[model samples]
Target chain A: MDQHPTIDTRQTLETPEGTDLSLYPAGFWIRSLAYTLDWLLRIAVVVVAGIVLGASGMGQGLTLVIYFLMEWFYPVIFEVWRGGQTIGKKSLHIKVINDDGTPVTFAGSLIRNLLRVVDFLPGFYVTGIIASLCNRHFKRLGDLAAGTVVVYANSVAASPVLESVGSRPVPDGFNTDEQRFLLAFAQRSSTMSPARQAELAQVLAPAVAPGDPVLAIKQMANHIVGDRTQSAKGHLL
Target chain B: MNLEQLRIAIRPRRDWEAVDLGLRMAQQWWWPMLRVWLIITSPWLVAACVMPPEHQWLVSLCLWWCKPLFERPLLMILSQGVFGVELTTREVLRATPRLFLNQVFLSLTWRRFSFTRSMDLPVIQLEGLHGAERRDRLNVLHRIDSGPASWLTIIGVHVESFLMLACVALLGILIPEEVGAELWTWGFWGESRTGGALLILFAYIAMAVVGPLFVACGFSLYLNRRVKLEGWDIEIAFKRMAQKRGLPTVAILAIAALLQLTPPMLPSAQAQSEREAVKEEILAIKKGPDFHRMETQRVIKSTEKKEEEIDFDKGFWRALIEFLTGAGSLAAAVAGIAELLLWALVLLGIVLLILKYGSWLERFPQLLPHRRRREYRPQTLFGMEVTKESLPDDVSSAALALWQKGEQRPALALLYRASLTSLLTVGVALREGSTELECLRLAERLQQELGIPQTSIRYFSDLTRAWRRLAYGHQAPSDAEGTALCRDWAQYWPEVTRG
Candidate 1:
């Protein structure tokens, strides 16, 4: 088959402990969002702590410690204890992990969070952004130095129902993924613009049927996404 | 493909690809994106509608600040859309009731003003992980291949502001001069009540459109990052291959996945290489190539003893003696021969001067061909790309050979490079670093200044355009298209000697 090869952009990393970590490093946007969310919480803590600590006689000293802990140990504490979710990170669904896809160890978290100072640079994480942009995994200086990776926390369930109500006889030579792609193309076509539907259809037309295959592909799609109308198997014809 | 068929539904891709995907995905789920925006902004919309005109700026500011709140639902829509599923507005709203506390806790912070908030939405809003797990997951998800999402959010916000200003300005243009005079006054954004209201309205529109797009972009980037991390594309390919061959491919995937986790034996080698990659590829390209020019050939003369002065005197004297055949005529002929010999020596001196300093004398227009002569020995030019390493001989002959072999583009490129190389005489000082556009611009500027003929300039310009169109624009030229251009090659470059 003259296959349109599926290009995998995953960065496969090996661990010191010999675990293969396939990770897609989030870019500036995702990391920045998590940082923003975390920063917001940090500010709230500072405000509350300032009031509470200012009331005490040992105010300034206690405040500095709180600031240091929140700034440095906050991410580390959350990542080590909560399996990588901070209050901010949980909201966004991103997590910290070792470069090899293992749980972020305490040492790894400490190194990464500690190196955040370098990532911070003279001003607004400028060096970090540049570092992230330069690398394929979008690692900031901290992540690079620490050998940590940021990845999307996958959902456990994969049972989301597609449109298919009953079995449709897929062609013999076709694989499960192709069949799934064909079904997806078919299901998506109607909901999509006519031109987009055709475009998607046209791409997979040869896989289903090579010559004047548009109608045949559509029929196959119709077969796969069984009729929704109750009682009768509407694919009678 | 047309706008309707922009791109594929799902795949692991880069930042630009994510941005592009967001825009394209919006085409299919534009309804959901718009609906989510409309629903979230309804309070503001109604407030703006019902509030007094004077107080609208406050409403606008509030709406702008609360964009984070509105973005949550749309983020859901976009996240689902990334997986080829569009979430209904009702479904999104319903799921959010239980997650209200999480959303509120996430929203409250000074970081709301921070630009990086755009990318962070996915971790907090979508994932179920908490504490250390969440942090670890964030570590995996946060290092997005697409730089920082803050750029898009910030740029999106700025673009929205610009769009608002332009729209308000356009609206301001419509009013009659008498009523609109104050509208055109400086600081109208804050000054006049009417202008302020217009600004607010446009700002609202900007928010309505850009807010959804902002979420969509973030969501797409987030999804792409995860897809890349999980090796979804590789898994899909393997799964497909397995189904085709009826082999146990899932186990192979496990092994392949396991291999990646195994620690690299040569970590220092990787680190060393990383330490060495100081200058990025883009910077090197921008620095461009160095220029080198060959010196023109100097005319050399040979002095030999065979150049004895008696040669001309003997022939003339013998001829005079044979033809005239008298004492008085012979004496006259000898005197005439001496005078002729003196004139001949002077003529020889003049010819030697012209031959020895021909390049200097050719500077004068009427004395010789007004040519800019140079040796055809350019080793490299045009970003150091047009090298004659493959063709070691004259350019035209090499080009002809290439053309015969059906190498149309290379042949044209070679011809153009040679012309530019020849133009080095007129101080074209083109360096290896000079880009194609730079070369064309230099050639264009020099055309009139160097007094190159218009038709010849057009030929070079056509060749440049054709070469560029083929190389960069990905368009190939028609066959036998430049036959006339080829025949008039001499006219095109009358200055330089033929290569």
Candidate 2:
């Protein structure tokens, strides 16, 4: 794990398995949108339940029960049983999990949900927004107290498709990070301008001097991703 | 502009991640950003505050309309800050006029509502692009990041309002309830000049907080796009590679040698064979579990769903709806069927429970009342009265007489009943409706629990078989078996004989 200070929102958590999991905490805008969606969904559920149950004549007390359950346990049930996501969180590709990168437990979910009252203090979740802004992990009071965090469920950027160029072995003197950047360069080649691509490849001219640097760099990338057959073709050529 | 001095991680990021990176930037440099924002917007806010209550709205509108001017300075500080340049408050203030000079009129007027204003600001200010160049640059940048940039503005507006309302709500909360009620009576919401000014102040505070974040996030989005489009990370890596090797002259020589020593393309047999072998290995690896995995699972799904897109003409819809709503007969019928099925399932569950565990109740007497304390014996066994008073004083002799008179079946039944009555006395707890087989099972258990004579148990078992044959199958026992049962009964239960 590279621990040098950099401005990014990644929260790296080490699991009991001795592996580090990278979690990206969702920011205020996305969280607010999900929260609004969940609020609307809860209201719609309560209203529909009230109307349906009201017509059945056993409504008042049951409706209060529904209100109470939906208010408290709706989030708890969904977070614990539904893979740590409410419907809103699921739709937004975010989920609640233990701070240690484990699935949230029932107690954790309950404590987090129960403390939503505090997060909503002074109305409009002003306290929560402020606290999240202040914290590195964007945790509100409830998340902090419950030892949970809301994180983007899938934060891995899909590798861009690289055009097939003949493969080659990476030359000496490149460290792992630079080697990874070569792969990134090849992956993002589709997005870069042709002139920009040539410019970037020119910087690696010393390492891949015997061949076309652009072709050589992409070949190394293909080899890095386990496509080794083309290297034979390059060898024959 | 030095890649080494760039504060942010230089990897190409997804658009949302770029927005998040902007948030991190804002968080990192919040104080400087906030200071610059508050300083630039202070004069306008003060001007708004000093206005008459009725003119406050106009003043606030102008203050809001000139937000682009205030944001320009914030962006200037951020752009520098991201490159490890921490501008002092004085530097930011001094640079404010120059920052606002480029396209200020257009930014304040027609381009005010441009959703990607923050993102486009960098192109105009930092890159110094204008006219068609600026438009073309925005077009290229907007292809990937415009959605998030626009959403940043949209969400930024909502956050501003929320924070503003929260400021008012905070004030309301701090005041005691009695004072708060009085505040309403004093026109806190409407006409009070202090209240109106206070509203504008809260709105200013909200804008100040959100503005820096909005600008930073948009700037980050723009930077992230450039990173993708130009491979800044790769460039940084190349710079490091260059510095480590320290071989610019060497690289130029190598390029010259490489151009001169180019080998002509010629396919060799060895290379062809190697390619074939590699292809074979690749295919073999592709066939592994990592590539092709088969899994089986069983899932229960509802099978009764119907397609719901039945097209309805006007008259048909009316008639169908009426029929469906004819006192809700359809709904009632569905509910009725569901209720019946549920009730049937419940009843079946109860019956199955008892049938499966019925013997457990007898084995564990505490499950129900033991019923042994009553000491009340049944007067009948298999519908025959078996009381001592109902039997003859000498059961053996009476059975023997009945057998000699050709009443062999009756004689055997009398013997079986008398043995059952004796077994009850010997502590076999039988029910009133126990069959002959039940009596035999209880007697067998009694033989184990109470050290009853094995001979008597065997005799009872033999008598039960004979009696079941005579009673159920209507098959009479032979004279020898009847006489043998009568003879063995006296030995098994001498107490049953009249004393």
Candidate number with greatest DockQ: 2
Model 1 chain B: lowest-lDDT 10 consecutive positions: B288-297
The superposed Cα distance between candidate 1 and the true structure at residue B166, in angstroms, equals: 1.6
Assess the local accuracy of residue B385 in candidate 1 as a C-alpha lDDT between 0 and 100: 38
**lDDT of candidate model 2 versus the reference:** 0.76
Q: On residues B74-165, what C-alpha lDDT tens digit does candidate 2 reach at each position?
A: 87777776667677765666656677888888898889999898898888877777889989999999886568888888888988998988
**Deviating ranges (above 4 Å) for candidate 2:** A1-4, A15-18, A232-237, B249-499
- Candidate 1 wrong stretches, greater than 4 Å: A1-237, B1-10, B52-54, B96-100, B130-132, B144-146, B173-181, B186-191, B242-499
Give me the displacement of residue B478 in model 1, in angstroms. Answer: 61
Give, for candidate 2 chain A, the lowest lDDT window spanning 10 residues: A51-60
State the lDDT at B371 in candidate 1. 43
Highest TM-score against the true fold, candidate: 2
Q: Please, what is the whole-model Cα lDDT of each candidate in the order they appear?
A: 0.59, 0.76
